[model samples]
Target: MSNGPAGHVARSTVRPNYETGRRGPIRTFLRSADGILIDSVYDPGAVVYGSAENPADAGRSPTRDLVFVVAHGFTGDVDRPHVRRVAGRLRAHGAVVTFSFRGHGRSGGRSTVGDKEVLDLAAAVEWARGLGHVRVATVGFSMGGSVVLRHAALHSGTVDAVVSVSAPARWYYRGTAPMRRLHWLVTRPEGRLVGRYGLRTRIHHRDWDPVPLSPAEAVPRIAPAPLLIVHGDRDGYFPLDHPRMLAEAAGDHGELWVEAGMGHAENAADDGLLSRIGRWAAVKAG
Candidate 1:
């Protein structure tokens, strides 16, 4: 790994290992449709076998069979420990690709928060496809949850499956302390400054030119490709109604799991829950 712009860690790109019939880890920057450079990493999965290993490694498959592209929440990047933990868990099922949305890490441009982030995810998914994975699944958290919903709707049939966690059903105004503070964090100059210095997230000064599609509206369009909505019943950001709305919109094509004691997004998702999600992705992609 080498130091990238603004003193962020950046990994070097490596060629795929053809001899092993697997791809090597590749670290590179991807260009969003709007031209923002997104910092990304592709990790090949570790080899695993059934209880008894056969001469041909019977139940084992190559690392590139499926790829999970992880999209993190607001104020999150590919390098965050929580994000890394999530990626590490998914690696048990298949290859993992994680990237920092623009303005979050070494990626260029300011964040419009969630709007236009679809372009960033699109770029990452396109890159994952180019890596030659047989299947691709998108796993997103919080702000990224909203992004993945919009992305799957916007680019129908592009991804094989999608998992959204702790996403809002619509543009919400909860009057809750966390949601209120979060609004302030994105809407005010002082909050933006704190975000830049304290959180290392740069907020864009401008608002959406044309308001982007909301998660509720997007969910109805995500059919044909599998959708899984995972939210915490005790989530501080959004409540049970949010996931219910999304699942209702999704109709038969979507599945909802409201964890009993979970809180919110990546920080709240435990190892066992993440393992279950990884396994679900592996099955859906298969």
Candidate 2:
């Protein structure tokens, strides 16, 4: 966005417009910058790119050159029902791109949790670009939500807009019961066993060589790029402070929405909320 807060990258911010239709999904496996194989799916919208010969048809569509790149939560993959539902709802606003994180589903490599998963998201965003999309809006949930924030900070000029749903502001938090249990899964042998066998998520054993940037820290760097931080008052893993901290760091550059009676992540996101997110991403990216 604005030279990465004075001397970070000096790259110019990207502002775009968007419009949408729908077709079958095209599945593909792509390689990340780190040589990991990522399982990805592309859902084409109603009108093909460059297919609207008549001006009226083009005017009728609102998401012609836009794409929504969805990043799922921990333990989620491309085939998950919640993820599918999100893609289905977002198709009405633009084309959708969903992919498995490194250690989830058909993707290859162990999960680094939120650290290395940024590479996975980078791969998916690149894949969307190769599909002829000019506008890219990243929509992430939970752990994926944190990843998107870091990705936007590290890979500026790639994403037109960002929507982080239910993300944590900092790292190593153990206040919540679910978060305590999650730390166990990532730090203990038996818990890792359960994660592999029960949750089907293969977690890496090594700790972060050097701790990466936190979501709150990344927020300040995303200035001039539209960011929407959505949170629920009833999230089990993270409390309202998580989103609030992020909003504070984002200052005037980001918008925060505290949904009434909402819970957590993709499992808790309803069709109505998803529709609003889709429409918001379209307008912001455009």
Candidate 3:
């Protein structure tokens, strides 16, 4: 709940206007794509760029601008460094909104890895749309990336562009060499104690389900909307091949950025990466 060293809390700070303490009104609506009315809210600061018409609804608009939505990684809130960095850059250009996942930070319920996150994303998108973000773009990290991928596949028509940095399309984490070790390390009594007793985190189920709830199963359904896949060369956790697989599934519609020394969406404030993402979003939103 404290700000970063720079005094910025990214998306964690509660907006005074949203008296409920939850972002927006925490409302729910049924999305035609998924046949579910999910929870969501419009960011008070979100704005439409370039077009007068809302991006979610295609119609005559004064400007066809874009809004950027920032999603955080696993165990991370909207105020994490990565989210803050991206939010700062995107906000400098226009409206930028970020929110915590359910059961994470200020939201309600427990983390569902990437499954329930789809609902969280739907809510965020709906909120952005309500704020007049006619052209919506998303930037997500780690597990957040997987959520974005799933959302795009389900609501391709509404999402104008997506930037998934450090997301592995297919999940075989328990099979990866390092992940194998890390899994052993984390699932052990000591690690489990830290995550459970120390952090008091709850698992969806105990034992036997370490395999990431993969989003690769949803990749084939995503396309047409421009997607940029950014991965670090040293990300042993997600594996480099994961991005390659996701890009391949994109079938010439997606672009990949493997940073030389980057790791898991690190250095998000770097000028080059920021510029690339911003430009990519601009072009895609158009």
Candidate 4:
């Protein structure tokens, strides 16, 4: 690991008996629209056991032909355990690119919550495409979920498929305790201070100059490119109506899955669920 300007860090590892002759996962910083240096990592999928039923040539096929760009939720970065786990599971289906949004982890700038996050996701998606992957799918959770939806809508034809989990359909929702607390966390100076110190996330102290499009409004423009909306039935944040509204806006092009007994975002996503999502993205990209 080596550190660079503006809190950027690059990390890679060497493996023995390497056949691909490629270096370890590439880690670097990408510049967002507003000049924020977004920390990112790209992992070229290695051969892994495909399925229990197929043993002979199961691990021979590599998933590097496709790419999945993963965007994490609020306060989550590429290095977080849950984020790493999500990336690991998706590697079975394709190459994985994960990034830390502005104001999170080592990335510079303050979070506009989800308002300006579309640029962050856009940067990551662009970086993924630059890596020579023919197909790219974006998967995001919570705030990052909203970011992916808006990014896909704003930059048409940039992504092949999109998966948004536990995202709010509209903004300014405070129906639940967590949402209420989150609003407090993003709306007040004290809250921003707490977020910066306690959560390691820096919340911008100003309101959106011109409020961005809501996720529900953005979903309509994402057609032709497949979309998957996954929300937990028991989610404490935004409830099922959020996903329902988003899916409804997406019409025939969108698929909705309301997982029972699940909660919120990436931390609540199990390995089985992640694998299923990865496979779904790979199939959709095909």
Candidate 5:
């Protein structure tokens, strides 16, 4: 719930800005609970430790105590510009961790879509905690959005805050053309070739043995953890009803923001919107 026991670690003006003085951006391979290799990156923002207490840092978010683990959309990896941009914007508010799900990018295995991706996010969150950030938040886009909600529900108090952007409310949604195309890509053998060589995403052929919990179904279980549901009014992949369903399931614990003229996933997210999200995560997670 409320940032666990370290929710209010005494902000001392003494610690060093360990994020800086490091050799380079933190990049490493992490192992999921299921032993899958996950490629992860950590971007330490330019803010120094204890800087939040400075008079000059008054208006801006100086969130050294928080880390945001960002989950990319379907076919997305940590290397993609859109995913990197999301990491860049989030780092302004705190340290950021970005990772490629299993079967995406250089990672091993095939994408089970939103089902097993929860393990990938869990691995990233564990790494964030290992980095010494007491508070952690997860921000996911589209497919990744579904992963974050399910991750929160399954992992319980592992994450302090959760933000799902442009995510579908349920699984196997074939309402939109994009959704239909996506299903074809995942379900068909030839389409799997397109996903592998064309999209650089290795999609699993087997269907979910047991369907994982849907985003809307998982929302109620994420209660007490700060949850933010964001969608674009003009999103092509999933309409406003998707976010509405998730928000309704969240009841009083979740916050919703519907942007005007926005599209879908990370690409549709602008700098201003990302900045607002970063600020919200900092405040809520801190």
Candidate 6:
């Protein structure tokens, strides 16, 4: 019940400036786990060593460390630079495998925000687990962060750890004057009308859910397994306190990273930030 409907947490935001690098093509594969045919894709340009072609090459070695399952934000595809950057970073650290969430890229199903997406995350984890990886961690950006939190909360003892960047706990809240003004201006009558029937609708898929899955509500349950909440002090959509509130809601169960000038998921490569998360996951999974 941490970041749930009854939770009280102030919202905040930072300046909005996003940039991503040109990504190479994706390596597609169809793998079945728990009866779900997960459409997994990876950056071929990011391939460090070994070949995904040989089934043995894909299998994790007994000495293999940990595998990271990367999830991207809303309206994000696997080809996005942010996704690629994170995957590239993890791969450089020798992550076993990485892939996008269901319905985001070549994956199947309609976006359910964090609702059904949690199941997709579970499937992805099960896929990695089946591959002989001893420990697993998930890194999610924006909406994907919420999905990761929900998955961790539900499967607390199962997952090793979780990291959420620029993920909002309360969907509706005002943290700063500019953020409040922007929220009112953008979510007002015109915004509502547009979202309802306009050309640029926020919820596009027919299966989109109106109810936002409050990850804060799920954070408390993600204990035992470490959780890392990373957010930009300069995020535009959600405020800084959103992450703070999520951290507080998580009690002593998790750690938080409040970067000074980071924005949403689409920022430059912050190897330090990613390294901190990587270390945290490595320690937790170990």
Best by TM-score: 1
lDDT of 4 at 37: 79
Give the top-scoring candidate (lDDT).
1
Residue 218 in model 4: lDDT? 97
Which sections of candidate 4 miss by over 4 Å?
Answer: 1-23, 48-64
lDDT, candidate 5, residue 185? 94
- For each candidate, the alpha-carbon lDDT, in order, equals 0.87, 0.86, 0.63, 0.86, 0.86, 0.63
Of candidate 2, the 10-residue stretch with the lowest lDDT total is 3-12
List ranges where model 2 is wrong by over 4 Å: 1-24, 47-64
Candidate 4, residue 260: the lDDT equals 87
Per-residue accuracy of model 6 over 53-98 as CA lDDT, tens digit each: 7655563332244778777776566666767667767665435345
Instruction: Report the C-alpha lDDT of model 1 over 131-225, residue by residue, as the tens digit.
Output: 77779999999999999999999999889999999998888455568998988988899999999999999999887778889999999998888
lDDT of 2 at 91: 84
Better of 1 and 3 by lDDT: 1
By TM-score, the better pick of 1 and 5 is 1
- lDDT digits (tens) for residues 17-71 of candidate 5: 4675442466777777666777778777656543555766554433336889999
Error of 3 at 122 (Å): 0.5
**By TM-score: ranked, best first:** 1, 4, 5, 2, 3, 6
Off by over 4 Å in 1: 1-12, 49-61
TM-score of 1: 0.91
**Residue 141 CA error for candidate 1 (Å)?**
0.2
What TM-score quantifies how close candidate 5 is to the native fold?
0.89
TM-score of each: 0.91, 0.88, 0.71, 0.89, 0.89, 0.69
Candidate 5 Cα errors over 4 Å, as ranges: 1-24, 48-64
Candidate 3 wrongly placed segments (more than 4 Å) = 1-64, 175-178, 181-193, 196-202, 206-213, 266-271
